[model samples]
Target: MYDWSALPRGARASLSVAGLVMAASFLGFGALVRSLEVGLLPGLATTVFIWALPGQVVALDMLASGANLLAMALAVTLTAVRLLPMVVLVMSKVRLEGARRWPLYALSHFVAVTIWRIAEDGIDEVDRPQRLPWLTGLGLALMSSMLVMTSIGYHLAQSLPPLLAACLVFLTPSFFFISLFANAKFRMDYIAIAAGALIGPLCHQYYPEFDLLAGGLIGCTIAYLIGRAGRKRSK
Candidate 1:
C-alpha cells in the first residue's frame, strides 16, 4: 500500500496547474480515440504502454485507416523518436552520481512532453538524492490523472459538440507554446519557437509526411547558428 503522507515533493508540485492542464489534454485524446471508433481498452492501453500523446495519436489514426501492423509500427516509432532528446535531457537533470541504472531506465518511460516540462522547470528545487523519487511521483500522478480523464472523455465523447472536442484536443499544444514562451531564458529559445511556428504550417502544407521532423530540425538549426554567431560577435 502507498503512503499518502509521504508523497514526494515533485508529486506534490504536480498537483497544481500543470497536472490540471495535462488531464485536460488527455481527455481530448480519449475523445479522439472514441471518435475513431477504437475501443476504450485499447485507448487506455496506449496510455499505459505508448504514453506519448503524439505517438498514441499516430497509432490510432493508422489503425483507423487500416494500416498494416508494420506501417503503423514504423509511423509510431518515427513520432516517438522526438522524445529521445527529451528523455536525455530529463535523465541528465535527475540522475544521481551513483544511482542505480534500472530505475533511470524505468523513469525514462514517463518522460513525455508534460512531465519533461515539469521536470525542466522545477526539478532543481529537489535535493539530488530525492530528485528521482520526486520525478517518479510526478510521473505517477500525471499518468493516473491522464488515465482517469481519458476514461471520462471516452464515455462523454458522444455528447460532446464537435467544436468543443476540437478545442479540447488543441489544449496540449497550446499549453506547450505558452510554457515555452513563459520559460524561455535565451534568445535562441524564442528564435526556435518563432521559427517553428512559422515553418511548421508551411511544411505541413507542402510536405505533410515529414512536416514535424523537418520543421523542428530546420528551425532549431537556424536558431543555433544565429545564436552562435551573435555570441561570437559579442565577444
Candidate 2:
C-alpha cells in the first residue's frame, strides 16, 4: 500500500482548487471524446500520452474527421508547439545543477500549463534536491485525478447536457487566469495579460488562421518593450 503521508508537498498541494479545475476541464474533454464516438481507451490514452488538452482535442477532432495520419500528426504538432516555451520555463525551475539528464527529460512530459502554474506557485518552498521528486509526485497526482475524472466524464457524457458539457471545457483557462492575476508579481505580467485579452480577439477577427500566434507575439513584444523601458527609468 502506498503511504499517503509520504507524498511530497507538491503532491499534497494537488488537493487544491487547481487540481479540481484541471479534472473538471478534462472531464469535458472526456465528454467530447465520447460524443465524437471515439472509444474511452483512446481518450484516456490522450490524457496519458499527449498530456496536453489542446493537442488531445486536435488529435481527436482530426481522427473523427478521418484526416490522414500525416495531417493529424502535423496538426497535433502545431497545436503542441506552444508547449515548448512552457517546458523550457518549468525545466529551468526544477532542474538541479549537474543532475542526470534522463529524469529531467521524463519530467518534461508533465510540464503542462496547470503543472507549470502549480510549480511556479509552490516550487520555491521546496528544497532543491527534493524539487524533482516533489514535481514528480505532483504531476502523478494531478494526472491520476485527470485519468479518473476523464473516465467518469466519459461514462456520464450521455446524461450530461450539451451546453453544460461544452462550458466545462472553459474551466481550466478560467482558473489559469484567476491564478495568474493572483500570483502576478510584475507589472509586465499584468500588461501582457491585458494586451493578450484585448489583442487576441482582434487578431481572431482579422487574421483567423494565425490569431493565437500573432496575438501572443505582438502583445508580449509590446509588454516586453514597455517593461524594459520601465526598468531603464528605474535604474
Candidate 3:
C-alpha cells in the first residue's frame, strides 16, 4: 500500500537530528570506555554487540571494578531485560501477519529507547507496509552514526576537551526528554515522567546497585495506579 519513494524525505529529515544526537551520546560513552582504559576494540565491540547504552555502562563499570563474570553477566542481563516491553509494543504496531520471521528477528535488535520513541510518534504517518522499511532505514542510519561517533570518541578521547566531551554525552538524554514532552498526548505521560524524576534520584542515593530497575518499576506502577484511579473517578 505504500511506495518506497515516499520514505526518503521523512527518513532523511528525522535522521538528520536524531542521528546527530545519538552520535553525540555514543561519543561520550566511547570516551568513558577509553578513559577507563577498557581497550578500544572491546569498547567498540560492546557498542556493536550490546547496543544498549545503560547495559554497556553497567558492564564497563563492573569490568573496571573487576567484578566477577557471573555478577557482570547478571547485571547486563537485568539492564537489557528492560527492552522487552519496548520491543513488544513496537512489533505490535509495524509487524505484518505472515511476514518472514527472520527479518522481524533482525529488526527487533533496533527497538531501543530512541528508535521506540521515533517509531511510536511517526509510525501512524506511514503506510502499514512501509512502516517497517521506514523504521529499518531510521534504525540503520542512527546505528551507523553511533558507531562512527563511538570510534571518534575512543580514538580522540585525549584530544577532546573535557567540557566539550561532557556536552556531547549530555545531548542524548536532553533530546530524549524534549522529544518525549513534545509528543506526550495523555496525562499519564506527564505523571510517569514526573514520578520517575522524583523517584530516580532517591533510589540512586539509597540503593545505587539497583537504582535504575527499582526506579522504573516503582515510577511506572505509581503512574499506572494514578491513571486508573482518575479514570474510575471520571466515570
Index of the highest-TM-score prediction: 1
Better of 1 and 2 by lDDT: 1
Q: Which ten residues in a row have the lowest lDDT in candidate 3?
A: 1-10
Q: Write the per-residue lDDT of candidate 2 for residues 80-189, one digit (tens) a residue.
A: 87678888888888776766777788888888878787777877876777777778788888888889988988877777777776665455456556866875777888
lDDT of 1: 0.78
What would the TM-score be for candidate 2 when compared with the true structure? 0.71
Per-residue alpha-carbon lDDT of model 1 for 60-177, expressed as tens digits? 7777777778767776886688689889999888777655688788889999887788778877776667777778888877788789989988877777787877776666557666
Candidate 2, which ten residues in sequence have the lowest lDDT sum? Answer: 1-10
Highest lDDT, which number?
Answer: 1
Q: State each model's CA lDDT, in order.
A: 0.78, 0.77, 0.74
**Clashes by residue pair, model 1:** none
Candidate 3, 64-140: lDDT as tens digits: 76777876787788768868988998888888877766656777887887778777776898787777777777776
| Angstrom error at residue 190, model 3 | 10
| Over 4 Å off, model 1 | 1-7, 170-235
- Candidates in order, TM-scores: namely 0.73, 0.71, 0.70
